[model samples]
Target: MSGSPLSALSWRKSSLSGPRDVCCVEIAFTGAATAVRDSKNPDSDALFFDERVWNRFLLAAKTGEFGPN
Candidate 1:
């Protein structure tokens, strides 16, 4: 992720994001990995995750694995 030029990638904000939202993230899918970046800092470096790992994270999130206990 360090050597790649993320600026050239086409990024999209989540459907949950809104015009008035102050905290949001944007994502881009590469051939081998998914990249995520803070919407407030598009020019900054992004965090990259393997496709499988990203999918698992999404599933867990949907199932409330990250919810407060």
Candidate 2:
């Protein structure tokens, strides 16, 4: 992590993001972690999650488990 390998990643936003939406999350994957960052602030530090945790979160999201919160 000392060399900032994340900065070299090719970050991508969701296809659903529209031209008018200034606030979106971009994601990049490394061998050890998944990185998420604000599309509006690419220079800011990104949040990293373990691959297993990221997959579980995606599954929950797809299932609508985080409703009304």
Candidate 3:
């Protein structure tokens, strides 16, 4: 769950997100942490992984760790 930092923060979602907005992710930079959320349901709760963890996730993603055939 997120704290007050995410309350009034401005979020930035990937521009490549489809028009349907179903397959989308949103991230907010609050200096100390990064907030990730599902664009399909902005009001729903979000997950806050440490920035280091987030970077590791990104590295894995870039290397096709979650890729398909």
Among the numbered candidates, top lDDT falls to 1
Instruction: Compare candidates 2 and 3 on lDDT and give the better one.
Output: 2
Ranking by TM-score: 1, 2, 3
Instruction: Give a tens-digit lDDT track for model 2, residues 1-69.
Output: 436776799898999887965668999988789999998777889999998999999999999899853
- In model 2, the clashing pairs are none
Clashing pairs in 3: none
Candidate 2 whole-model C-alpha lDDT, 0 to 1: 0.87
Model 2 TM: 0.83
How does each model score on TM-score? 0.84, 0.83, 0.81
lDDT of each prediction vs. the true structure? Answer: 0.88, 0.87, 0.81
Point out where model 2 deviates above 4 Å: 1-4
**Candidate 3 on 14-64: residue-level lDDT in tens?**
888778886899998777778888887777777887889989999998899
